[model samples]
Target: MTSIISAVPACPQAPQAPQAPEVPQALLAVEGAGLTVPVVGGGVVEYANLDYAASAPCLSDVAEHVARVLPYSASVHRGAGFASQVCTSLYEGARRDVARFVGARDGDLVVFTRNTTDAVNLLARALPATAGGVVLVDLEHHANLLPWRGGGRRGTGDVRCVATQPTLEATLDALAAELRAAPVALLAVTGASNVTGETPPLARLARMAHDAGARFFVDAAQLAPHRPVDMAALGIDYLAFSGHKLYAPFGAGVLVGPADWLDSAAPYLAGGGAVREVSTTGVDWATGPARHEAGTPNLAGATAIAAACRVLTALPPGAWERHETVLRDRLLRGLGALDDVVIHRIWPDGGEPVGVVTFSLRRHDPALVSAFLSAEHGIGVRAGRFCAHPLLARLGAPGGALRASVGVGTTVAHIDRLLDALATYLRVGPGWGYAHRDGQWQPTPDDRRPPAWVEQYA
Candidate 1:
């Protein structure tokens, strides 16, 4: 494939172009790319992080952007110092950048939050009374499901959940029935499954919601990094995503939607910046984004997210999709070749997605297999319910499964490394001994250690 990452800079570089010599020139440069760790068998190997869905590594470009802005970093909004003014501009500009990245329409508000969970909660709290009840799909991540489902929360509309069907068409049909049966205000769903990487038909779902007189909301935390989230074109009324999942490892996320519900409803946070006037008896709340973004905002995190957006948005057309699709296909095909390896997916008709693959080994312990991958092969993957317990139960894997997710920084080499490691583990079994401890399997007498700096903090 043509190199979409590590592209030559538009501006000529200084005398000797600055680059991390050890980091591989892959789809994108990420933190800890070239770090080598000692394996259980007395050999060192480059650490392969296949856990991007959990929290992606920071992009090198975003890190540089953050370093350049650090000198000017200061408290944002209404601060009188020069650094504060600069930071304010950077923070607000970051909001605009995120809005554009998601194809926000006019009158849309971009409210920054701690992460996707905070963004979802803020939206749930800001839902207007007239918007009717919320209709959620059973496939949502806990971030999206927990907020609206909470009891006695102000502005959390009457919540109802619809279980997914065997197929995408049937699932949409069921959602439509639920919406038509009730005076539903919103149809909340995940743009893609974090566990299976199966993307629901978002455009069709959006249309179904509108036809039933309900608005559409997507948990785009998984979709934004791999695919474009054109909210306007997709007819999404509200969307939430996290920067950490987008290669910006910053504690920031955003809610992009119309300002009407947010403006009319109670402020998400009742603190200093959210209010216009503070009286002993009653307080006046501000409007627009400020109405919700209370407390000292994450200016640095917002700036980093904006830097990540800029980097991702500048990619050539179709480059991002092509890169992930090719690599994921390679992984799927390799895993398919393995006997008794059950790859779990929500829909057989699942759409193109980010590179997330969840699988189970029938004769092996999933946690043990994952621990072996890390300790013996220097590969990092997630093994658990993946915070989507409902989906896990529905998939018949209540015991949890192994998840290997790729990112913009992931490469064919990384994909092959994981496949090879799994094959080795399954064929020969984990050569090292592991014991279940602290609710997880650990290699017994593990000799691998973190870099010295990690010890310094301890």
Candidate 2:
């Protein structure tokens, strides 16, 4: 008997849109291949992780890379088995990958540290005693600022912090004057601002520092994740950045560039990886990355970081910028249209920035605003001083302002939710009997409709 099987229906697939199905994870994330983490709320809130200037979630691809290598976790370099040999190869390979990722010298040292904080601290301590003077920016994050400050405290050098200006022209002029004033040995600067998302004129600053007989050190913790950072092209003598901020979030970082300061100065930490010999009379140190690393390095973290970099570099650079620009412009336009809200240096002009934006509303404490958004709207945002105490102080932000940072994961819907919640708060006043406490304004229950004066953003 000729039996015919019933025809099976094709599995339903989402209809393709004209432009990649509208990129549900937002433009940046979609372009960067970054993934979003789900919240407990009903609507899937794409993680508007503008705090990428601080830290970013590990890319899904990097996580996969880490998983694939998990089964072969063996001691590297101190090989005893096949697994050890494989682990060592991967570790060294990761170094080469990271070096290329940042456009470092072919043979440059790539030391793996815990994070940017550790990397900067390593460089700070590793500077030779002869390097008696260092210039740093006042707007630097504590990770960058405190290291030099601590170095001065340890009597290593006289750390001079150059005061910053709100405008770039004024900043460059002041920096030039400062560099000309003395025999500067090192100039430490942020490639981009974590608060205002402003990036200084890197190539110009590099030339100025070099001309003034100083080595330029770039704290690229915020810049690397967004754009291409070529150490040689920028003429940067030393560069530091964290894996966490670069979509790896793997307990590791990179300290790349000149080897002289790292080679001659006393090791930052001393233990297994840094030494070649140890005795009562003397201790012989290993050369290159191992010298600074000293202790057991996080091999997995380094490999994962390399994996994340590979994923990021695969995308078209222009696409990354274009996607973020759309989101940034949307944020600026929306925030600007709102009544009583002031957007700081709103997009395109004030300085070359990334997707991060900061703003404040009239009579609203930033802390309360941030807390309310989290509690009621399921919008996760950051508020208060964003670690750079001096910068905030300079901005006259006595209590700080609410910061909404966008990353690869941020979507237009996220911005809309933020705008909606703010409007609701302004119109209805506080809800659920929220009251100000100890100098903070508290929210009180009121009619759902907010005050009439509150305006809607286009």
Candidate 3:
């Protein structure tokens, strides 16, 4: 692969360069599965695709799994064809796999939706009418918060929004106070901060929620890929996550929890699969997953997600943890040395965090930073509110900050590219300040074209 460098001004290097394991070429292989992004050139398009918090790349195993089943696609359950039987078996098998993936209890229902947002919306709509006074963290993603807020607008109850504080203890204190003051139905919190990558105290929060007689729904979108999750051990009542974030890249998600709420409530989307029977006067809703999966489900997508779970299970947890920690620390150290960069968080006391790091460039819009990284340096990252508008608004970061999220396939070279870009951009000072008429950022001529390697996959 070629190392592509843009025309940004240069800065002095630090005294030392950290020594880490060489990034494996096999892991960087995104070939053979269709995409032709090249890996060579002086301006080697070094893809530091650090946006795993939003979506991770599909694993080779997942792609193969989908391919193996694609030829057998047919309508499941209703048709008696051989292909249909295979499809039905694979789809249901995927459900069982998901159940095991989350450590679901016997008879726990796994309802597949398009994504975490859809799963959360399903839960929100299904909660009993008496589910008043839901508790939410100020740091929650829009998908987790919006459903409840929208429902509250219909007069469910006083939906309490817990304010942020200096520490987790303080935040928990405020949450406890809110739960005590009202009849709370549920407490929704993230397993990790998408912005900070700091995982919340799930066990402690779970115990607290149960003690307060409220169900706990954890948004594990970020944590599932980095670590193992045992919902039963965590004592969470409900759990939601997406396949795309788990290296599956499929339009499938899971909402697993206690069956009472889901069973009694109406289907989220009124359609064929959800109804057991229909008459002129009324309709009977099926129980468990069928009730919520109203339309034709994405059987292949579900299989891919299940395949991702199996692939992740084969990985050595200790190695995965060690590698990610080293990568994160290396990147943090490099970014920390930059005078203009302000990182969101670093575990000074040596606490564990996921492979996500967020920051802001001084006196610059985050979107510009992201654009320069991509257009000039061949590094892809996400910027802006990241769909957590409330959290961004609370932090007063209206345009949001540049967020570089890593994953299992990421490497040290990728991190180096990001640091080098930042150092270069710092010397240039908000490179090319003219705003486009369409409200988009237009980088200089040097940044207009993508790196040469990108054409390999184009």
User: What TM-score goes with each of the models?
Assistant: 0.92, 0.84, 0.89
* lDDT per residue (tens digit) for residues 31-59 in model 3: 13222222212244445677778888888
lDDT of each: 0.84, 0.72, 0.76
Q: Clashes in model 1: which pairs?
A: none
- The whole-model C-alpha lDDT of candidate 1 against the native structure comes to 0.84
In the range 1-458, model 1's lDDT, one tens digit per residue, is: 21111111122111211222223226778888888988986889988888999999999999989999999878899799999999999999998899999999998999999899998888887777667889988878899899897652455457888997998788878888988897878888998889988888788989999998888999999999888889999899999999999988879999999988889878877798998999999998999999988899888789999999988999889888877877777778778777668999888777876788999977567888888888888899999999899999999899999999988888777777887777666565667777776677777777877779999997
Model 1 misplaced stretches (Cα beyond 4 Å): 1-25, 155-157
List ranges where model 2 is wrong by over 4 Å: 1-50, 151-156, 346-350, 433-458
What ranking of all candidate models by lDDT puts the best one first? Answer: 1, 3, 2
lDDT of 2 by residue, 141-244 (tens): 89888887773333355788878765667777888998888777888898877887777778899999999988899988888877778888888888888888
The runs of at least 3 residues in candidate 3 whose Cα sits more than 4 Å from the true structure, single-residue gaps closed, are: 1-17, 21-44, 152-155, 346-351, 429-437, 444-458
> Candidate 3: deviation at residue 131, Å?
3.3
lDDT of 1 at 106: 91
Q: What TM-score does candidate 3 reach?
A: 0.89
Ten-residue stretch with the least lDDT total in model 3: 31-40
Q: Candidate 1: minimum summed lDDT over ten consecutive residues — where? A: 1-10
